[model samples]
Target: MRSFDSTGVMEQNISKWELDTPALCVDLDALESNLATLQQTVIRNGIASRPHAKTHKTPAIARMQLESGSVGICTAKVGEAVAMYEHGIEQILMTTINATPFKIERAMNLRRWCPGFVQATDTPGNARALSEAAQAAGLVADVVVDIDTGGHRTGITAGQPALALAQLVDQLPGLRLRGMLCYDGGAQHVRGFETRRARTLETLAPATETFDLLQRSGLNTEIFSGGGTGTYNIDHETRGLTDIQVGSYVFMDAQYLAIGGATDDDVYSDFETSLTVLTTVLNAQYEGRVTTDAGAKACTINQPWPIVKGETGMTYSSGSDEFGTLRYDDPSRTYQLGDKLEVIVSHCDPVVNLYDQMYAVRGDRVEAVWKIAARGMST
Candidate 1:
């Protein structure tokens, strides 16, 4: 279906290639496998998963993750968490700092309704603001101090500063300090297994030290939440890590694949590439090159360009808004004007935001079509 609504498309043996151009297709088998693999790893390591919903932006997928043993979910924005909360996702962690009056008010509303909602904050001003609003609402807001592990992103500095923030959050009225968030976003794509592991350990060291400081200070250090799919296997060894916030494991993309894992020297194969932007060849007029309907608007234009599934020696460029140009050196396969191809996106999150629904396909059969309910919910 060209349109996003696939109401009657469920339970049909429809060829994925037959779906409309630039359709988002997910291999259910791969999806299931990825979920199981991560769950198994976390369970075995005595850690829990708080999968980030910002990647899929689907409540159905969030529910699936919870059912697969995820303790809760994480959303980067107030709007995304609100969208998820409306759809029966009770347990959520809003990972970004909600500072503005409007955002804090909206967050308090969500906190009032969902008991499991947790907010992450770094600065004292935001903590005081959240406390003031929460106290006005007559409820205690659950919050975590965001600790900047190494990425130097939005988080308070580790060591005494993190502990101080936690202490401040603890003393703030109408606020319950749950734990610390130490996400090193930069370490998640370090390109080599040994190199990444070293960087991850080095970066997370300060956070672990700060976790100790929080614990020694008699604060609730129960939840030391952080870690991505890249460092999932490595982060379990962290001194205070309780759960990992792995989002992209559900839909491995080109950026993740290039990072290289422990077993694979040049590619991170811990998870399979399940999500793909399905594109149809629109023009085959030129030799050694073809144009597809999925361009920057469809598949995204990130580096390590889209990988043509099941085909080798094919380079894809979606520099244009309307078409992705594909060039192949040798003819392993010939393409017709209508031939459909799937490409593992360079980045899954933004690519997902561009779509309206994802077709859950098992081989050539369509089992379900999950709406991109929170698509463009970024605020």
Candidate 2:
């Protein structure tokens, strides 16, 4: 609505820097490359890509992921799945366990309409509750047993505990046991590639054994899904890994980039940094220091503070509520009022949750504005 284009992009020839300050942006070229790179890599390695939607939380981007050969998209919240479902995104795996009375009702309501919906469970009680709700609704719910691969965030233990849960899911009325989610989320952020690889395999060893246990027990073990951006290349090395739930690869940030890449390059060069925050310098009174409009509210406070794109020796800080501190020891260039700079964010997921929409841009041109439709879908 702001500029001139039939497709809702800004006026022709308007650069991305011309956009409003503190805006979230997706560099379309880098994004497409990232998508194609990850999709091609995972597919070639005989692994399926079921990317997580909680990163961008945009249905448009989810559709892109699906088109790029992602088997489905993963969502951390039930409402995020519901939103994607409403957008006609069929292949969805609800990665979070929801057993609350109202949440169960909501999941059932969604299951009634979403044939591609698959839910995750970690505990026996939650699994039982889900089956009961599914049975009452005359629908059989599909689910994955979330095996905690050292994340300790959710899921049952490996070996006996995990196998028992899978067995229970198999026998439950109105429930179909899809497989297990052995996501080693904790290992994904390990700094060195080899170190991360070792941690992932060591963490996943028992979980893979559990997968074998499920198969030996004659239960459905079709989907042994779990992996993240940091461990995508390394995950396929493990046996029975059906898919890697790679999320942030589509729009990398400072946190992921800091983790060394496959060749141990000290920067995760496997994926490009496609997501960014566009901010304008609001004040430049102090030498070697400038204030930007992107503060904690815009960029979020996860370090190593947001990196000023293409400019080394420049540091960014979102210390203030509405202004960011740009500090430099020596001069690369002088900053002036209203000068725009793009900085890669520390974390992409929660920062995305703060924005209403993100502008997709090609070099010097706005391509589209995608709404973060599930921005605050905490449930």
TM-scores for all predictions: 0.96, 0.96
Question: lDDT per prediction?
Answer: 0.91, 0.89
Strongest candidate by TM-score: 1
Model 1 TM-score is 0.96
Q: Could you give candidate 2's per-residue lDDT for residues 1-379 as a string of tens digits?
A: 5666554434434678788778889999999999989878887899899999999899999999888888999999999999999887989999889969799889889999989899999999999999989989999999999988776888899999998999999999999999998787788889998899899889999988999999999998888899999998999988999998988998898889888987865889998899999999999998889999999999888887898988877788997889999998665666899899999999999899999889888986888888888999999
Residues 1-379 of candidate 1 have per-residue lDDT tens digits of: 3777665443346877678778898999999999999999999998999999999999989999999999999999999998999999999998899989999999999998999999999999999999999999999999999998756769999988888889999999899999998898999999899999999999999989999899989999888999999999999988889999999999999999999999986989999899998899999989999999999999878888998988887788999999999998875686889998888999999999998889999988878888888899987
Clash numbers, per candidate: 0, 0
RMSD of 1: 2.4
Once fitted onto the true fold, the runs of candidate 2 whose alpha carbons sit more than 4 angstroms away are: 1-13
Residue 262 accuracy (lDDT) in model 2:
76
